[model samples]
Target: MAIEDNPSREALEFEGQTTVIHDYAAKLVPGILQTEAYAREVLGSGARPKSDEERDRLLSTRLARAGILGDFHSPVMWSLLDEAVLRRPIGGPAVMCHQLRHIAALGEQRRVRLHVLPFEVGAHSLLDGIVSLMWFEDLPPIAYVEGLRTGRAPFCS
Candidate 1:
């Protein structure tokens, strides 16, 4: 869940038009379904095993293909789950019960909003990790933070 964790103040008031930010939980869908089921079980053999309603319909068709890009809108502020990410159940238990029922059906969209920060909401202030903010149009707002490898862009000056 990252598009700079929701930082598109109307895509920074609209300018040229290009605001891409992604994190998708570090792109870890059980290590990409175990590397696409070991590359379709060695490239072939009709390797199949994606039930749970076809992995929640391929994660709701990749979240509606990122809401069809341009003018894409989501996170009208609220998806903050962290209680060990809803009790850490990744691709098990029916892929975490169909990924928590496909994140409760994409939080019954209306521009989604699904808060769940309870692990007792312990610790504080970004817990020494995860950050993203962007707003482009008139360009003047960007903050990205990620590590344990590298990534840190701080703009807005």
Candidate 2:
């Protein structure tokens, strides 16, 4: 079960209490941490700017506190983060370094997998916008494709 949030595609307004986005992230993080291969394939193995060693240490500590290590032990979970995401300095040099190091550590886990879709990969089906797919135990796969005006749901056969 992978719950991915694309800031560009999703308009997440901060309301009091737990927003749907945060709820989704919180729910999925545990599963993602358990699957080491999936974590590496998405968060790690991406290009980023330079940073210092202190930032790396901070990232490790944060990851551990966040219970990422426990998540790596799960057998059925993963998530994907674009290369552009890893490169983007959401915070600053230190923050970015910590984040990237966290990603790299998660990547090193055998059960986790991270994939970097290079900028050169160019446009694809998701170029127009963002979409998410959810797989349920007793139900068919559901996909949510959102646009500026509205969204649509398509079932996966």
Q: Evaluated with TM-score, which candidate comes out highest?
A: 2
Q: Show model 2 residue runs off by greater than 4 Å.
A: 1-69, 72-75, 128-130, 144-157
Model 1: residue 67 alpha-carbon error in angstroms: 22
Q: Candidate 1: how large is its RMSD?
A: 15.8
TM-score for candidate 1, please give it.
0.25
Candidates' TM-scores?
0.25, 0.43
- Candidate 1 lDDT over 43-69, as tens digits, reads 222245455554543344333433532
| Residue 144 miss distance in model 2 (angstroms) | 5.6
lDDT string, candidate 2, 1-157, tens digits: 1113222112111111111111112112222232233322223323543244533432343234334234433322244544566566544566556656765776676433555556687765544543545454455555445443233444355
CA lDDT, candidate 1, residue 138 = 50
Error of 1 at 82 (Å): 20
Q: List the residue pairs that clash in candidate 1.
A: none
